[model samples]
Target: MEKISSENPSIEKTKFIKSKGLKDKPHNYCPGCGHGIVHRLVAEVVEELGIREKVIAVAPVGCAVFAYDYWNFDVTEAPHGRPPAVATGIKRILPENFVFTYQGDGDLAAIGAAELIHAANRSENITIIFVNNTVYGMTSGQMAPTTLLGQKTLTTPHGREVLRDGYPIKVCELISVLDGARYVARGSVTTPKNVLTTKSYIKKAFLNQIENKGFSIVEILSMCPAGLDMEPLETMEWVDKELIKYFPLGVVKDV
Candidate 1:
């Protein structure tokens, strides 16, 4: 067997290319957190589209608040639940540049819901990367807007109640109904196939903006092992076996 080592001749022949849109450094995400994966996907898509230089990203006030540190391109911060509104202004002002926002479920479906809806209603030419982990990961696993029914969190000790907490918000479904929302989709990172599918969804969202189609969003169901108090593998299994039943997967709209 060929040993994989730096001293090995074969190892020297191999090339490890990092995404041009991503900085070469360690991220602060927890082990098994899907933020890192989604970040790479966004970076790869931006680089592959050859728009890294012209891309502008809005960072959400969630676990990924430090997203600017990892992304090599220009990134600006937005107030909690305000990325969509901020992105709208940036895209309108710099119509020639590619703009996008990276937001968590809490930032998007909860506090930012109004901004997102209005942005989509106006058909803002921007892409949105919505990561739904079903909990407020940075806030000690509190119940988020997208938290599944009956799901337990720090705030919901005995699982969520439908009458009390209401049903989980389905952002893609809600946004797809808007006439200005040209594209909306839901994807997951629970498996290799799903990961690739999610990347394709993100790429499509970006392309839609380039074509001036309208507002585009890709809601990614991601795993948060630490927030869920489960092992990485177990959290992944939960997403596949339980969470997906409510969220499902695939394009909700494209027109």
Candidate 2:
């Protein structure tokens, strides 16, 4: 019998190759929106891991709904706020394949809170890439669960009031408190350095899934320039100063 490693030498070579998962079509994300950057990092990580063919990505119904178009892998569309439930079913049925869910803040933290928490508590063998941009981008800038205090959105025209909406949900910290989650980290794509770190975290999350370590999630604090009505550069600066102040950068939990 041919040795598995010898039979797939490209697996080793893939680590040094450029990603082919991204499509040439320009992404529709607003300039400086961190979702695009995180998407690229995830594509690169999947390429480096050489699991593009066997991987299954569940795209959530939000701004990232078109993610399947960019990723060169088997993909399925899940209802709004249902990616975690879909990912749980997919991973449970096909344990050999790598399963992942990509979701926006509104989808994951608001409508899908139960699914996210339950999946993590179950220790499902799945990886989740959670993008927290603080607004409902595809739905016209509604306030999301992660929206900061006093931030105005289409839904909260007068800014989010603490008395009514409360503060932003710190998802990483919340999930880290769960015993079933093997790894939980908060990352960002605000700068090139941060992008690189995000990629490393994604890769580690994928590896942990392959090893059946348990459910893992990487919450990325992304920018939404159009929604925020700020220029691209200014949006990035805001991420560095304002966003980071609320969602401090670092791994919240890894086990």
Candidate models: Cα lDDT each: 0.92, 0.88
Residue 120's lDDT in candidate 1: 92
Tens-digit lDDT track for model 2 on 71-122? 7778899998999999999888888899999999999999999999999999
* Candidate with the greatest TM-score versus the true structure: 1
Candidate 1 C-alpha lDDT tens digits along 112-176: 99999999999999999999999999987999988888888999999999989999998999998
RMSD of each: 4.3, 7.3
Estimated TM-score for each candidate: 0.93, 0.91
**Where's the lowest-lDDT run of ten residues in candidate 2?**
10-19
Clashing pairs in 2: none
Maximum-lDDT candidate: 1
Q: Please estimate how well model 1 matches the true structure, expressed as its whole-model Cα lDDT.
A: 0.92
